[model samples]
Target: MHVPDGFLDAPTSVATGVVAAAGVGIALRRARAELDDRTAPMAGLVAAFVFAGQMINFPVGAGTSGHLLGGALAAVLVGPWTGALCISVVLLVQSLFMADGGLTALGTNITLMGLVGVVVGYAVFRLVLVVLPRKLGSVPVAAALGALVSVPAAATVFTLLFAIGGTADVSVGKVLAAMVGWHVVIGIGEAVVTGLVVSAVIASRPDLVHGARGLARRTALRTGEVAA
Candidate 1:
């Protein structure tokens, strides 16, 4: 979710900014391991796809709207660190150029969308893959499930943040319920988006997809490391 300006207090905002900066720096360093001639283009395409997908916001509740987080999709197609950077790049571009998210809340947005979303989603995905039959089809299915679960996870994180530093004195219970409820629906969209994107990348150039590349040649299943 793109947190608006004035949503969090100054101290919290600054703190989140520092966290976001550190995450970005770490991602920049780690993403080099994931990026290559083929993956570089794929990364660019994933970023653009995420950007365009975010532009189409869906009604969450009453009048509020939400968009595709795209972290799980990018992480599955690219790599987790690269996916975080890609999503952060999209958020930064949108915040600075389009003013979609508040400038002051950029750090908060990145923390929630880029770091939490990617990490949580990818973890869920890998776990699911470990449990399921490691077939080519399973990758997309796991991606879908991961994406579906991650939206509510992100919403839960946001609710916790709001409880800590929210300017408004809203009921924590209500906020959590509402946020999670709406995000469950939003997660369906995430599932579809993640599944489609992962499927596409796996179909065309499985080698380029960091998640899919771990699969063995015979079963298209991961041989080692659990497709992390």
Candidate 2:
């Protein structure tokens, strides 16, 4: 979720800003290894797609609407490091141009959605892939599950941050419960969107999907051996 200004104090925002900056710096360096001619173009497309996806928010409950976080989707389509950078770019543009997320709380949004979301989501996807069959079909399933888990995880992290530096006098437990509760429903939407997109990409251009590369390489090798 794009956190607005005044939700958190200046100190908390500054701390998150520092963390976001460092995370972006690391991502920029690591993304070079992940990006190539073929996938580099896909990165731009993925960013645009995510930005657009975030614009349409569906009502979850209690006047709280949720949108596609796009962390798992990006990480599954591109590499995790690049995915972090992609989401950061989207958030930056949204904050500056659209004024969707607060400028002062931009770092908090980046840390929550960009850093935590991508890192945790990608990790979950990889873990699921390890347990599941290493086939093209498994990629979408893993991506869906990853997307499902990531939303609540991010929400939990945000709740914790709010407890530490929330400007309003709110019950931490109630906030956590409400945040996680609504986000679970939102995760379903996230899962559906991520699964559809990942499945479509795997169907057409499996090479562009970072999470499916190992399976692709293995399939290629098997095909070559059979030909031989």
Candidate 3:
């Protein structure tokens, strides 16, 4: 959901930049507590993976394309604070080097794809896991659903922003319908990939997955039972 320059009015864009800067600054400080030796390397890898993942864009109905935002994936692999930072970093690189997103609109992209995406996705994932049975497999399922929902939620947020500050004269209702409809399909792909990756990580190194901590505890208990 990269909003190109001129899509939003100048005042709106500048306002979003201010908000984005504040959010990123908070995230950087929060990341200091979340980052560690193990996660530091993994954070870079996650950023690279997100960067690569975004390259393979699926066509939307309006001739536009969308790709993995990777918020939920990053949050699951690392931690939420680091996940936000990683996505922001990837967005910044895409803006500067790839010219994929406009430099001036960088803050808008970060707010939608990085901050809002991660916050909503991670919160949903945690809530789902808490409601579901605390089995080892639940973690991946939760992550999958989180990834799925995050896309549309971000789209909805964009629609709201556009309604507030969009240059185009499109009806807010139509924009919301189009954005949410296309993102539903995107969310399906997100669910599949996120579930697979999270499950694989839990199988091999559950310790590495932030969302799999409960799963690890349950597995350890089962192993202890069998040993007994």
Q: What is the number of backbone collisions in each predicted candidate, taken in the order shown? A: 0, 0, 0
Which has the better TM-score: candidate 1, or candidate 2? 2
Off by over 4 Å in 3: 59-64, 217-228
Pick by lDDT: 2 or 3, better one? 2
* Predicted candidate 3 versus true structure: per-residue lDDT over 166-210, tens digit per residue: 998999999999899999898888888888888987887676677
Model 3 lDDT vs. the true structure?
Answer: 0.87
Kindly report which residue stretches of model 2 are placed more than 4 angstroms away from their true locations once superposed. 218-228
Model 1 segments beyond 4 Å from truth?
59-65, 216-228
Task: Estimate, for each residue in 1-228, the C-alpha lDDT of model 1 and write its tens digit.
Answer: 899999888988998899999999999999999997767988999899999999888776688777789999989888999999999999999999998889999999999999999998999999999998967778899999989998999899889888889999889999999999999999998898789878887786566677765573643434223444
Q: lDDT score, residue 84, model 2?
A: 96
Give the 10-residue window scoring lowest on summed lDDT in candidate 2.
Answer: 218-227
On TM-score, the stronger of 2 and 3 is: 2
What local lDDT does model 2 show for residue 45?
98
How does model 2 score by TM-score?
0.94
- For model 3 the TM-score comes to 0.91
Model 2 Cα lDDT, one tens digit per residue, 105-146? 999999999998898889999999999986889999999999
Candidate 3 has its poorest 10 consecutive residues by lDDT at 218-227
